[model samples]
Target chain A: MWERNPVIFLLLATAVIMVGTIVTMVLPFAYVNTERDAIASVVPYSALELAGRDVYIKEGCNNCHTQTVRPLVAEVIRYGDYSKSGEFVHDRPHLWGSRRTGPDLARIGGNYPDQWHYDHMREPAAMAPGTNMPPYDFLDNRDVDPELTRRKMEVLGFPYSDEEIQALAGKTDMDAMVAYLQKLGSDIPWREQQRVTLVGELVNPFAGDPAAIVEGRELYERNCAACHGSGLSGGFAADLTALNYPEEIFFRIIHDGIQPLRMPGFATLGNERLWKIVSYMDSEQVAP
Target chain B: MERPAYNYDIVKHFVHWSILWGAVSVLVGVVISFQLVMPQLNFGEYLSYGRLRPVHTNAGIFGFAVGGFFALFYYMVQRLCRVPIWSNGLARFQLWLFNIVIVLSAVTLLLGFSQSKEYHEMEWPIDILITVLWVAFTINILMTIFKRREAQMYISLWFMMAALIGVAVLFVVNGLSVPVTLFKSYSAFAGTNDANVQWWYGHNAVAMVLTVPPLAVFYYFLPKSTGVPIYSHRLGIVAFWSLIFMYLWTGAHHLLWTPIPDWVQTLAMAFSIMLIAPSWGSVINGYLSMNGQWHQMRDNYLVKFFILAITFYGLQTLQGPLQAVRSFSGFIHYTEWVPGHVHMGTMGWITLLICGAFYYLAPRLYGRELYSIPLANLHFWLVLMGQLIYSVSMWIAGVVQASMWHSLNDDGSLTYTFMESVLAMYPYWWIRGLGGVVYLLGIGVFVYNIAMTARGAQASPGAAAQA
Candidate 1:
C-alpha cells in the first residue's frame, strides 16, 4: 500500500504537514510573550487617530513603511534607541514591512510637525522636493464623512467613543492620515546624551591640534592622493574633496567605511587623524 | 489504411514563437540593467523603472519560461500518452493568443497600466485575458491526459498537473478586485486580508510557475538528454506531492517579523524549512539518474546543462530554507541577499534548463544538425559565469549591508544613516550591471543560433508530423 499508490503519498504528506504545524507553528505560540517596558510608553490611540490608522492600512502604507527597528548597532546609533519587541505587544497587525519604499516610521512623531506630514502626504515632491514618493492628494477634502471614518474603524475593531467621533465630525481624510503619521516613533527623550558620551570615549588627545593637519596632509599624500587627487578635488570615480559636501561628511568617511561604494569607512582612522583630514579639506575653503 | 505520422508541426510553431518572446524578455531585461547604471537609459514618462520592472519580470516568466513549457509539454505528452493532442485546433489558437497576450503585456506595462502587485501587476483586463487563455490551455492538456493510451502517467505529468491547477487557484484568488476605472482597480481584500492574499499569490507563483513547470520540463528533458530513464519514478512522486503540500503554507515566510500572527509566521518558517526535503529529493534523483552516465557530462552539451541546472536547484533549495529561519531571515530578508537568491533560481536553474531543453529540441524539430554546437557551448559558459558573478556579488553586499544596518553604539542609537547604507550599494550595483551584460551577450548568441537554424534546415523523421 505504501510503495506505489499516489493516495498514500498524499496522506503521508498531509500527516507530515500536521506534524510540522505542531512542532514549528503551534508550539512556539505557547511561550512567546508580547509584553515589555516600552509597552508602558505606547498609549492607545484617540478616536480620530484610530480612523487615520485604518486609512493607512487601506492604502497599503505598511507595504512601504516599517515600524520596528531591529536591535542592531547601526540601527540603534542612527535611529535613536533600538525598538523593543514589547513595543508591538498591543498591535493587532504589526507594521514591520518587507520592503523600504520609504523610510521607517517607528519614531516619526514630533520628528516633523503635523503640517509637514500634511504637505508631504498631499505631494511629497512639493514638501521634500527630491522624494520619489507618489502623492496622496485624494485624501484632501474628500467626500468621506467623519462618521463613516469612525464607523469603519469601529468595524475594524478599534475601540472608539461615539461622542468623540461626533465632536470631530467633518474632518478631512488627510487629518486622520496625518494623525497616524504623527504617532510614529514618539517615545524616546528628545536629547541623546549617551551617544555623545560614547563618541567622546573614542576621541584622540590631538583631535583639535594644529600639528595633526600637517601629519594628516602627509598621510593623505602618501595613502589617499592617488584616488582623491593632489588638489583634493576628487579627480576620479568618487571625488570626496568635492566642494559641495561639508567637512562633517569627511569626518564620517574617516569614521565609518563605505563598502559597496568602494570607499571603505576608516574604522582604524584615529580621531586625531580624522580631525586632521577634516582640517586639510576645510583649509581649501576660503571661509566665504 | 492511412496511419497519420506524429505531429511535430505544432511543436515547431510553439518552439519558434516561444523563443521570440524569450528574446523580447531578455533584451528588455538587459536594457533595464543598463538603465540602472546609467539613468539616461530611463526613457522617462512611462518607461521609468517602476513601470519597466513589471515588463522584464512578466515577460521572462510568462513569455519565456511558461511559453517554452507549452511547446515542450505538447511535444512530450503525445509521445508519452501514445495519442495526439485532445484538440490541435485549440492549441493553434492558444499559440496565437499566447503571443498576443505577451505583446499586450509588454505594451501595457510600459504604458504604466499596472495593479502594482509584484508578478501579478498586469491590469484587471489583462488579468482576465490570462485567466481565459490559461483555462483553455489547461482543458486541452487535462482532457488529453484523461484519454491517454498509457495507463501509468509519467512523473512529468504530475508536475504539469500541479502547475495547471496551482496557477489557476493562485491567480484567481489574488486577482479578486473591483475595477474603479479601465486601467485601475482596488483589491477586494483590504488591510491584513489583502496582505495575506498577495503573499499567498506571490509565494505560490514561485511554486506553480517557477517550481512545478520547470519540474515538468526537467523530468521529461533530463532522461531524453542522457538517453536514460530517471533513477526512480516513485521518488519523483514522493517529491512532487510533498512539494505541493508544503509550498502553499510558505508565502507567509516573506511576511515574517510583520504584523501577521506570530503563529502564522512560525508556521510558514517551519514549512519553508521542511520544503528543503522534497526539493532535494528531485535533486538527488537527478544525480542518481546520472550515476552510471557521469561520463556524459564531459562529452554531451545537453548533459552539462542538465546536471549543472539540477546542481543549482539543490543549492538554491538549501539556501532558501536556511534563509526562512527566523534568525537568518531577520538578517537578510530585506537585504541584497534576497535578490541573489532569486536570480540563482531564475538565471542558474530555470534559464539554464530551458536553454538546454531548446537546444535538445531544435535539431529534432528542424531536421538539421545544430547551426553551431561550439556556439551553444560558449553560450552555456557565459550564462554560468554571469549568473555566478551576479549572485555572489549580491550575497557579499547583502551581508555587509545587513550587518551595518544592525550595528549600534553603546548608547543604543544607530551607527549608520540610511544614506550611508545606500551609498554602500553602488559598487556592487556596478558589478551586478557588468554581470547582466555578460548574461545578455550569451542570450544574444542563443537567439542568433536559433534564427540561423530556422532559416535553412532539412526536416527530420518527425518533421512531417509538425505540419
Candidate 2:
C-alpha cells in the first residue's frame, strides 16, 4: 500500500523533478550573477528611451521583432554586430523575443535616422513596402505617461533624476519608440554596416566612356538626386560639381558615403555602375 | 453495494466552461493567424497580435486545456479511488475561482498588463489569484487521494499527483517578481539569467501543463472507452517517472545557440535526446494496450480519438527533440517551424485528447447518448485536415524563410531582403489562415453537438443532486 500510496508517490515525483531544476537552474545561480558586466558603453535607458521601451512592450513589438543577432555570417551582414550577453545587462525582461515575423532589431540603432523610424512606425509600408508590420500610427498621438515611466525605471533599478523623467512629459509614444529603436545596439560598435571604404589598387572600368557618363546621369537622377540634387547642384547634401578630386577619389567617396553628412553608400549597386556615376562626375564642368 | 454518488455537477461546469474558453481560444487564434498575413486586421492597442497573442495562449492553455483537465481529473479520481470527492464545498469554490481567474487574465492581458512571461503572462494580482485557485484544487485532490477506498493507486492517479505538485513548484518559482505598480512587475532575475529562467518556465510549462495532465486523462480514459487495461502498468510507471525527471532539464533546449551557459545547453540537449525514450514508452504502451481491441477502433468513435491523440503525441515528442539539436535549432528556432511544432502538440495531441475526454464525459454527465457520431467523425476529419495544412504550410514557410535568410549572392551579400522573405510567406500564410478557419468550423460542430445533447437531457436522478 505504501508503494502505491499517492502521498509518497507525489513526494518522490516532486523530488525527481527538483534534481534537474537544481542542477540546470539553481546551481548556475551560485556563480552567474557576479561574473558578468554590462557592455562598456551600455548605460541605463534614457528617460525618453525607457518610456519608448515601455511602449514597445505595451504594443508587443517583441512579438514579431527579435532583438538578438546570432553569430552567423549572413546574420552579421544583414543585421550588424552579433549580439553579446553583456550588451543586454540593463534589460529587465529582455526583449530577446522568440520569433521573427520581422527582422532583428538588435543592431538597428544607427541603421537609419530618427525620422526614418518615426515614419516607419507611423506607416511601415511607406518606408519598406510590402512589409507585414501593422502601422503604429496611434503611437504618435499617445503621450508618454511620466508617472508610469518613473515607476518603471525605479522598478527596473535604472537610475534617473526627476528632471530627466520630466523631460519626457509631452513627448508622444512614437518619439519614445524611435528613441528606443535608435538606442538599441548603440552600446557596441557595428563593423558590419555598409559604412565601409574601398581601399586597394583601383581601376575605373568606365573612366573614359562617354556613353557610361550618359547612363550614369540617368542612374544618378533616380538614386542620388533626391538628396544630392540634379544638375550636380546641392540640395540636402554637398554640391558635387564643386568637387575637384581625381575620379578614383570620387569613387572612394561614393563607395563610402560621407558618414557625418548622412549620405548612404550605394554598395548594392556594385562597382561597375558606381564607376559610371564617377565618370559622369568627372565629365561635368566645375560649377565655378 | 451501489457506488456512492460523486460531485459530478462540478465536473459538468468545468467541462462546459472550458469548452467556452476553448472556443474563445480558437476564435482568437484564427484572428491572429490571419493577422500575420493581413496587417490591416490588427486594430490598435487592444485587439492587435501582441496583446491578443497572450490572451489566445492564456485562454487556450490555462483556460481550455487546464479546465478540461480539471473536469476529467475530478471525474476520474472519484471512480479510480472508489470514493466520493473530498469536500464538495471546496470543489464548488475552486470552480468559481477558476473562472474568475481566467476572466481576470483575459481582461488584464487585453488591457496590456502582463508579466511578459509566455504562459505565465498575467499580472501579479491575477498570478496570486491563480495560485490560490491551484492550491484549492491541489488540496482537494490530495485529500481525496489520501482517503481512497482502493488500496493500490492506479497509474492515472500517479500522473495526477505529479501534475498537481509539478505545476505548483514550476509556477511559484518562475512567477517570482517584484511589483513596481499595481499592473506591473519586474522579473526577479535580470539579463541572461532572466532569459534562462523564462525559457525554463516556458518550456516546462508545456511539460507540466500540457504533457502530464493529458497523460493522466489519457491513461484513465483510454482503457475506460476501449474496455481494456493498459498493456503494462509497470511500463506506465517507468515512463511516468522518467518523463517527470527528464522534462525539467530539457527546457534549456529552447535556449540553444543563445547566451545561456554552454554546459546548461549541452545538458539540456543530452536530456532532450533521452526524453524520446520515455515519451515513446507511453506511446508504445497506448499502442500495445490496443492489442485485441483493434476491432473497437473501427466501431468506436472514442477509440479513434484516443488512438489518433496518442499518435500525435508520438509525433510531437519525436519532433521536439529533433528541433532541440543545436544544428536543427539553428535553422528552425525562430521560424514558423517552432509554432508548427507547438500546434501539433496543442492542436493535434492535447486538443484531440480534451475533445475525446469531453465526448466520453458528456454522455455520462448529461445522461444522454451523443447527438451524432457522424458529426463527430466530420469534426475529426476537418480538424485533422486543418492542422495538417496549417503545420505543413508553416514548415515549408520556415524552410523557405531559413534558406532565404541564409542565401548569399555572388558578392557574398544576402540574396533576398527580409521583405522578400516575408512576401514569399504570403501564400503559405493564406493557406494557414484557411486551415484555422476549417479548424474553427470543426470546433463549431463539436459545440453544437454537445449543446444539443445537454438541451434534451432529462436531468438524471444522479446528476440532480445540488452542489
Candidate 3:
C-alpha cells in the first residue's frame, strides 16, 4: 500500500506530523486560560513600555540575552526566582532565547538605574569590562514613533488611553527600551516588600571623617553618578539628597542589593568604601 | 532506452548559488565566533553581534543547506521519476526567487527588522515570500512524482515528500502573527504557548531541513558512489516512518528546564531518547551497505565523507537525547556545551554530506573529471580537524562554566560572578575562532576545486561530450 500510492503515503505522513504538532503545540494552548483570573500580576506593557518593547525587538536584543529564567536552583540564585508561567502571560512571542551568549535578562527589571542602561548601551565596556555586547548608542538619538506603537498595542488588543500615547511622543528609542527593561519581572509581591524595607537605626562610622568623605565623593562619581545624576539630583534612580533615610539604612541597602530594583549590592566594593559613599551622601545634603 | 532529457540548468544554477551563500555564511560565522572574545570587532550599529548572528544562521541554514537541497532534489527527482521536471518555467522562477528571498532576509535582519524568533527571524513580508517559494517548489515536485514512469516510490522520494509537507506546516504555523507594521508582527500565541510553538518549529526545522533532507541525499548518493544497494530497504522505510513520528514530539526538549510544564518536558525527553533507534537504523543501513566497501574509504574521498557523516549522526543522536534529561540539561542548558553538540551535527555531518554530494554532482553536471582528488582530500582533513578542535574546546569550556556557575561557598554564597565565567571562556573562544579560520580555509579550497572543474569542462568541449 505504501509502495504504489504516493498520495496515500503523503496523506498518512502529513497526518502523523499534524497529530504530533496538535498534541504538543496546539493542544497546550487550549488548556491555558487566557482569562485574567488564571494568573496573578500578568499586566500588559504600558504605552511607553510597549514602545520600549518595540525598540527591544527592533534591536534584536534577544539574540544575546534570554528573557526566560528556568526553574533551577542555580538559575534562581543567579537570576531571581524561577519564572512562573503567569509572569509571562502577557508576553507575545516570548523572548526565551535558546542560546545564552550573555546572562539572562528575564529578571533585569529595576536591576540597574536607567542611566546605567544608557551608559551600558552606549559603551558596555565602561560598566562591565570584557562584555561582547555591541553599543546601541544610535538608539539614544532615534525618537520612538509613539502613534505607531499605540496603534500596534491596539492591534494586539491591549487597553491604552490616548493620553498615554501622547505622553510617549517625545521619548527616544533608548528611553522606551529602558522603560521596557525596567518593567520586566517587577510585579512580584515579594519584590515590592524588598523595596519598601527600611533599614533600622544605626550610626555611620565614617560620618565625621573628612578623608573618607572625599573618597566617598569620588566613588559616587564613578559608580553612583550614572544612576543618580552627576549633581546627585534625580534621574533614572532616586534623588540621593531628597531621601532622609538613616545612615544605617543606606549602608544596608548599599551592602545587600535591593531585590527587583536596579540597586545591585556594592558588597564587592568593600564595607569601608560603602561607608565612605554613605558619608559622602550625608555630607552633601543640608539637614531638613 | 535513451534516458529522458533531464533539465540540468536549474541544478547547475542552484549549485552555483548555494556554494556562494555557503561561503558567505561560513565567513560570517567566523566573524561572530571572534566577536564573542573581542568586543572591539563589533564595528558599529549594523554589524553588531545581535544583528549579524541571525544572518549567519539564516544564511547557513536557508542559503547553504536548503539551497543545496534544491539542487539535489531537482537532480534526484528527475532520475528517480524517469521524467523531466513538471515545469521548467517554475523551476527557473524558483531559482531566482530563492536568491531574492535569501538576500531580503539578510538585508532585513541586518536592518534590525526581525520577528526575534530564532530560525524564523524574518518579518512578515519575507515570511510570505518564503511560503510562496516553498509552495511553488512543492507543487512542481509532487506533480512530477505523480506523473512518473517508475512503478515504485524510492525511500529518498518518501523523505523528499515528508520534508515538503513538514516544513510547510511548521513554517506557516509558527509564522501565524498579527501584522503591526510593514516590517513588524506579533506572534498570535502569547507567553508559554508562544515558546512551545516556536521551539516546535525551531527544532523540527533542524529535523526537516537538516536531518531528513540530508538523509534523503545520503540514502540516494551513498549507494551510487559505493556501487552497492542499501543493505535493507525495509529498514529504511521503517526508519523513515519512525523518524517522522518521533521528531515532532522532541522539540520541547529544547524547553526542558524552562517554565514549560513538566509533563511536556518529560514527553519531549522520552521521544528524544526514542529518536536514537530510528536515527541509528539509517546509520546501520549505511554501515552495512559499506560492509565489503571499507577499502573504498582509503581510495574514494566521497566514501570518507559519507562514513564519517553517518558516524557523527550516530554520535549526535545519542548525545542529543542524553542532554534532554532534566538533570543533565540543568547543568549544560545555557553553556557552550550545547553549541558544541549542535556543531557536530551541522559542521561534521550535514556540511560534509552536502559537500560530498556536490563533489558527486559537479562532474555529472559539468561533464568533466574533478580538477584534483588531492585537493578534495586536503579539504576533508582540514574540515575534520577544524570541526574537532571547535567542538572539543567548547565542550571543555562548557564543563568549566557549568561547574563554576553551580559552585557555592560553605555559607552558600555564589562562588563566581557571571563576568568571571565570561572571562574564563576567552582561551576557548580564541581556539574556537582559530578552528573557524581553518574550516573557512577548507571551504576556500572546496570552491576553488569546483570552479577549476567547471572551467576545465568549459575549456574543452570535445572531451566533455565524449565523457
Candidate 4:
C-alpha cells in the first residue's frame, strides 16, 4: 500500500498535517474566548492605537521585541504579570516574537509617558547609552492615513465608529505608535490603582542631601547607565536628565517601579539606596 | 527507443536564479550582522534592522534554500523517473513565476507589508501567489513521478514527495488570514493559538524545506560522487518514517516555558529528544557509506563538504534536543544562543551540502570543469572558519547574558541592570560581524567559480573526462 501507489503516500502525509493542525491550531481556539465582547481585557483597539499597530507591524518591531510574557518567574518579574490568553484575544496574528534582541514589550503601555518614547525613538543613544537600536525619526515626518487604517480595521471586524476613525486624522505615525504602545496591557486589573496608591503620599527621602547626591551618582552609573545612558541623556531607554518629576512622584516611581515599562522595582535596594539614586539624578539635573 | 529529452534547460534556469538569490541572501545577512554592532549602517527608514531583518530571513529561506531545491529537484526527478517533467510548458511557467514571486517578496517586505509572523511574513496577496506557485510545482513533480518508467521509488523520491506534500500543507494552513487590505492582513487564529500555529509551521518549514530536501540531495549525490550506493536502503526507510512521525510533535518545544499547556510542552520536549535518533540515523549512514573510500575526504573537494555537512547535522540535531529541555530553555530561549544554534544548521549543514550538490552538478550541467579546485578548497575553509566564529562567539555571549540576567544580590535585588547585559554584548556582536564578512567573501569565491565554469572555460583533461 505504501510503496506502489503515490496516492496512499500523499494521503498519509495529508492526514498527519491535519492532525497537527487540529490539535495545535484549532483546539486552542475552543478553550480561549477570542471574541472581543466575550472577554473584559480583550477590548478592540482604539482608532489611534490601531494605526500605531499598523506602524508596529510595518516596522517589524516584533522581530526583536516579543509581546508574550511566559509564565516563568524571571519573565514575569521582568515583564509584569505573565500574559493571559484572554488579554490578547482580539490580536490578529499575535506579536509573540520568537527572539528577544531587545526586551519584551508585552506590558509596555503607560510605562513611560509620551515624551519618553518620542525621545527614545528619535535618537535611542540620546536616552540610553551603548544601544544598538537605530533611530526612527522618520515616524515623526510620516502622516497616519486614518481612512486606510479604518477601512483595514473594518474589514477585520474591529469595532471602530466613523467618528472615532475621523478623530485619527492629521496624526503622525509617531503619534499613533505612541498611542498604540500606551494602550498595551492597560486593562490589567490593579495596574493603575497600584501606581496611584504608591505615589499618593510618597516623598523623596534624600531630596537635597550633598553626600547622598554623590552616592546617587554612583548608583545611577552602576544600575541605570546601560538603558538610561551614562550621561542620563538616553540610549535604549528614556532621558532621565531631561524629564522633571516632583520628588514624591519620583520616589513612588523608583520604589514601585513602572511595571509596564520593564523597569524593575529597586525597593530591595532599601530606602537609603533608592534616595541616594534619586538625589544623584537630581544633582545631575541641577549641574551645568 | 529514444527517451524523451529530459528538460535540462529548466534545471539550468533554476540553478542560475538560485545561485543569484543565495548570494543576495548571504549579502543581506552580513549587512544585518554588522548593523547589530554599528547602528550607523542602518540607512534610515527603508533599511533599518527592523525592516531589513525580515528580508534577510525571507531571502535566505524562500529564495536561496527553496530556489536551490527547485533546481535540484527538477534535475533529480527526471533522471530518477527516466522521463521528462510531465508538462514542459508548466515547468517553464513555474521557472518565471518563481523568480517573480521571490522578487516581489523582497520588494514588499522592504516596503513594510509584513504579517509579522517569522518565516510566514508576506501579507495576504503574496501568500496567495505562493500558494498558487507551490501547487503548480507540486502537480508537476508528482505527475511526473506517477508516470515514471521505474516502478520502485528510491529514498530520494520519498523525500521529494514528502517535501512536495509537506510544504503545501504547512503553507496553506498557516497562511490562513483575514485580509484587511491589499497589503495588510490579520491571522485568523488569535493570541496563543496564533503563536502555536506559527511555530508549528515555522519549525516544520525548517524540517521540510531545510532538512528533508537536503537529506534527499545528500542521499542521491553522496553515492553518485563517490561511486558507491548508500550502505542500507532498509535503514534509510526506517529513519525516514521515524523522522516524519517525530518532527511534527516537536514544534511546541520552541515555546517551552510559555503559557502553552505543560503537557504539550513536555510532549514536544520528549519528541524532540527522540528525533535525534532518526537524525543521527541518516548521519551514521553517510559516515558508514564512506568506510572504504574515506580517502576521498582529502582527494575530492565534494567529499569534504558532504562529510562536514553531515557532521554539523549530527551536532545540530543533538544540540536542538538539549535546548528543548525545560531547564536549558530557561537559560537560553531568548538569548543569542538560539541564533547560534540556528546558523550552524543553515550555514554549516544545509548550505555546505547544497554547495556540494551544485559543485557536483555544475560540470555536468555546463559541460565544463570547475574553474579551480584550489579556489573551491579555499571557499570551503573560509566558510567553515566563518561559521565557527559566528556560532561560538554568540554561544559564549548568550551564556554570559543569561547568567547576568538571572544574577541576584544577597538582599534579593537584581545584581545587574538590563543595560549592562546589552553593554556586554558589543564585543561579541563585533566578532559576529567579522565572521559574516568572512562568510560573504567565501560566497564571492563560490559565485565566481560557478560563473567561470558556466562561461565555457577550458576543463583540465582528466576532469573533463569525469564529466
Task: Identify the leading candidate in terms of lDDT.
Answer: 3
In every candidate, how many clashes are there?
Answer: 30, 0, 5, 8
Q: Which runs of model 3 end up more than 4 angstroms from their true locations?
A: A33-37, A192-251, A259-261, A266-288
lDDT per residue as tens, model 2, B160-246: 888898899889988888898888887888777778888888888899899999999999989999988999988997999999999
| Listed models, DockQ each | 0.11, 0.55, 0.50, 0.50
Please give the lDDT score at residue A76 for candidate 4: 57
DockQ of 2: 0.55
- Model 1 chain B poorest ten-residue lDDT run: B458-467
Overall local distance difference test of candidate 4? 0.83
TM-score computed on alpha carbons, candidate 1: 0.72
- Model 1 residue A264 CA deviation (Å) reads 26
**Candidate 2 i-RMS (Å)?**
2.0
- TM-score for candidate 2: 0.91
Q: What is the TM-score of each candidate against the true structure?
A: 0.72, 0.91, 0.91, 0.91
**Winner of 1 and 4 under DockQ:** 4
lDDT of 4 by residue, B264-369 (tens): 6888889898999999999999999998999999999999999999999999999999999999998888889989999999999989998999999888777677
Find the 10 residues in a row with the least total lDDT in model 2 chain B: B458-467
Runs in model 4 with CA error above 4 Å? A34-39, A191-215, A218-253, A257-288, B1-4, B457-467
Is model 4 an incorrect, acceptable, medium or high docking prediction? medium
After superposition, candidate 1 runs with Cα above 4 Å error: A1-288, B1-5, B458-467
Q: What is the lDDT for A1 in model 4?
A: 68
* Off by more than 4 A, model 2: A1-3, A36-38, A190-288, B458-467
Each candidate: chain B TM-score: 0.96, 0.97, 0.99, 0.97
